[model samples]
Target: MIAAAPASGPLWQQVLVALAVFAAALHVLHDRAPGLLRRLRLGLARRLLAGRAPLARLLGRWVAPPPPAGSGQTACGACQKAGCAPRPADHMRNTP
Candidate 1:
């Protein structure tokens, strides 16, 4: 008996799925390692900018470089501006 071919859907659906997966991977990378992600983006943008071709330059316009690490603000933007109180205890609540 001959085996049947796999039921593959439209090319666009596959492309969309691939793009979504790629985006999610990038998101995870950014969330887990923000500094590494920032470096990667800055490096890519610089490489594009360094290219002589106009298309590269145009693409480089996107992927803006992250602000200098020192100047970067916390999520709330108030912690660095004002002062944050230190926690009385460093141990986790779940752990003794």
Candidate 2:
């Protein structure tokens, strides 16, 4: 988790710090770049699952499924360029 960099400090500095942290998190979320929102949900659930607090783990249990296995391309090419994440099948009828 991001430690608030002196949220009590000057407002402009706080805003800049917040934005930078947000951008960094966004980059981490999107670096794979193919399935953006799917990745985000997966990532958040994983984080919540691994969190120290019991409340977080409880929330995770409500949201996430068992982790995906062999999710990457096998060259058997399960779903074309899309990684075989469980999410894609639920929305197969809709466009991203």
Candidate 3:
């Protein structure tokens, strides 16, 4: 949306012209602000955290439910429920 400054002028002249135009525009918009910006921020935050139902539905899709209690009676029972093969205790015992 912005047009570049004229390229035919000297570099210092171009720099001064850009600074003057920026300062003049800033002076004009210094008033009549803040009302719309505050409302936009509130609307965006409301959209981000709209309801607990949406969050619960997303969690359900990504997470597998835990195995029922009292089902794992053996040493490697926990890994079996998680669908991974259990490692021998010798591998785990020497690490820590």
Highest TM-score, which number?
1
Order the candidates by lDDT, highest first.
Answer: 1, 2, 3
Off by over 4 Å in 1: 1-7, 69-96
lDDT of 1: 0.80
lDDT of 3 by residue, 1-96 (tens): 999876787989989999999887655644455444445445554554454677744544434333345876566545556435555664678654
Clashes of each: 0, 0, 0
CA lDDT, every model vs. true structure: 0.80, 0.72, 0.58
Error of 3 at 78 (Å): 57
Per-model C-alpha RMSD: 12.6, 13.7, 17.8
Tens-digit lDDT string for candidate 1 (1-96):
999788598889989999999999999998999888988888889999999999898888788575787784655663655346434464435574
Superposed on all Cα atoms, model 1 deviates from the true structure by an RMSD in Å of 12.6
C-alpha lDDT of residue 62 in model 3? 38
| Order by TM-score, highest first | 1, 2, 3
